[model samples]
Target: MRQAPSERGIDPHLHRDITELIEGLEFEHQEQERATAEVSWYKEHTLFFSLV
Candidate 1:
C-alpha cells in the first residue's frame, strides 16, 4: 500500500527515521574524529614512524 505525504512533503515516520539516521551519522563522525586525533597525537610524539 502507498502512503501519503505529511504536511511537510514527507511522511512523518520517514522524517523521524531520517533524523535518527543523521544523528547516528553525526555521532559516528565525532567518534572517528576523536580516534583520529588520538592517533595523530601518538604519531607526532612516538617512534612508531621513525623507521619509515
Candidate 2:
C-alpha cells in the first residue's frame, strides 16, 4: 500500500520515473488549459465583433 520514495521499500528509480511522468502530465494539462482559454477568448471576441 506504500507509494512514493519516502514510503517504505520504494525504489529510487521507480520514484524518479513516476515523478517525471506526473510532471509531464501536469505540463500537458497546463498547455491544454491555455489553449482552451485562448480559443474561448477568440470565440467571445469574434461574436462581439459580429454583433457590433
Candidate 3:
C-alpha cells in the first residue's frame, strides 16, 4: 500500500486512476491463469481411447 501511486509521489491527478488500473490488471491475470490451467488439464488427458 505504501508503494501506491498516491504514495510514491505520482501526480495527484493520476492517483485516482490507480484503483481502475489494479482492477484491470487483476482481471487480465485471472484470465491468463484460467487459460493456463485449461491447457494443463488438456495435456493430462487423452484425445482418443479404445473401449477394449
**What are the lDDT scores of the predictions, listed in order?**
0.65, 0.65, 0.63
**Candidate 2 local Cα displacement, residue 44, angstroms:** 17
What's model 2's TM-score? Answer: 0.58
lDDT of 2 at 31: 64
Q: Which scores better on TM-score, 2 or 3?
A: 2
- Residue pairs with backbone overlap in model 3: none
Root-mean-square deviation of every model: 9.9, 11.5, 13.3
> In model 3, where do residues sit more than 4 Å from their true spots?
1-13, 39-52
Per-residue lDDT over 1-52 for candidate 3, one digit per residue giving the tens place of the 0 to 100 score: 2587556687756766997789877976666667668766544333433253
TM-score, cand. 3: 0.45
- In model 2, the Cα lDDT at residue 1 comes to 68
Once superposed on the true structure, which residue ranges of model 1 sit more than 4 Å away at CA? 1-8, 39-52
